[model samples]
Target: MTIELSVLVEEADRFLDAARIQDYCPNGLQVQGRPQVRRIVSGVTASQALLDAAVAAEADAVLVHHGYFWKGENPCVVGMKQRRLKTLLGHDISLLAYHLPLDLHPEVGNNVQLGRQLGLTIEGPLEPGNPRSIVLVGAPAEPMAPADFARHVGAVLGREPLLVEGDRPIRRIAWCTGGAQGYIDQAIAAGVDAYLTGEVSEQTVHSARENGITFIAAGHHATERYGVQALGRYLAERFGIEHQFIDCPNPA
Candidate 1:
């Protein structure tokens, strides 16, 4: 069964609760396209490559974790931005993006998915009081040595995660998907033995060592691929629409 673009957009917006937060870019329907959507494509970003791939796939709509018009980005749609928008417009492909919402979703979110893949049971958010906190705290279902856990992350993510092991076993772990090294402090405050995120900055190394918390810099694209993929699969199964994930690699 096929669903209208409007209907799918509404469903995705409702699932992500896009109206609840002030995001960097428009959370839903960044670009308008055909009314009916039979094939849906998903990707990490709405770059030229991804948009071209979606167009090539004859996708009616493209869903993504990153989209055009970031919060602090220039509003003018020029240069690369213009090309990206042009591709979507020329193809009549609707663009739907979910940023923070995708990261924070309880069941299918990146953080939760990563934790589940690593056999971790989430205890709570890393931030004490923020219900929408991006950082999360959890414990392994069974204790694993720090090196072993690192190996597990590497194996599942298909990339060797950068490991900064502290002199402690990894029982309590904290994580935030996608370049959230700034949350290292929050993880430390949560009393977690280790903190994991997609990308790490230079200061993150020093901070981890000083704070006595182990840190792992998994690839940003690698870590975040799960949430959007899970969401697309869920939409496919529930709504009976064709869904495909277009992988555009980003090392950082």
Candidate 2:
């Protein structure tokens, strides 16, 4: 079953509420292609490898969490950027991407999906009364020691996470997926036992140590893989179109 590209893009934007959120990059339809869409390839990033895979799969469109045209990126389209755009334009494949919206979304967001994978029962947002709050507070099914929790995260994400153990076992914890280590202070203020995010900065370790809250730095790419896959499945189920999620693994 094929749907028009415009219809697909419109529904995706509306579903994610993309226009309302302020993000580093545009949220939807970064590249436009064929008028009719039958297949979509979803991934965490719009890397050249993923684009190549999508082309090989004969995808009509590409969906991702990361797309081109960042706020501070060089506007010139001469080198790598040109190559990536050329691939999509050459093959007539549309690119649709969502960033903060995909993280803040209640159902298929990255944070929610990561919590589900970790067996966490989310209590609420880390920052209450903020509509765009991406950090979330939740508790695992059982309280776990920092080491045990780190092992569990490694098993689930297929990558050994960096752990800074605190004074106590993790009971209430806060998490935000993908390079949100800056939110540790906020999580600490929330009085949680631990904080988890995709990347860890140098200062993050000190903050966790001083505050006596366990900190886990799961890989950025590892943690964000699920949201795009979930969104792809949702669109596939909704529109009765073929959707494939290709993982071009990133070690970071």
Candidate topping lDDT: 2
Q: Poorest 10 consecutive residues of model 1 by lDDT?
A: 124-133
Best by TM-score: 2
Candidate 1: tens digits of C-alpha lDDT, residues 1-252: 689888888988898787896767788888999999889899988888998899889999999998877767788978988898889888889998899889988878888888888778888787658868888888887777778989999998889999988878888999998989888987887788999999999999998899777899998898999888888988888789999998987777
Superposed by TM-score, candidate 2 places the C-alpha of residue 231 at a distance from the truth, in angstroms, of 0.7
What is each predicted model's overall lDDT from 0 to 1? 0.87, 0.95
lDDT of 2: 0.95
Q: Against the hidden reference, what TM-scores do the models get?
A: 0.96, 0.99
Span of ten consecutive residues with least summed lDDT in model 2: 124-133
| TM-score quality measure for candidate 1 | 0.96
Can you write out model 2's per-residue Cα lDDT over 1-252, one digit (the tens) per residue?
Answer: 999998899999999999999999999999999999999999999999999999999999999999999998899998889999999999999999999999999999999999999999999898789998999999999999999999999999999999999999999999999999999999998899999999999999999999899999998999999999999999989899999999998989
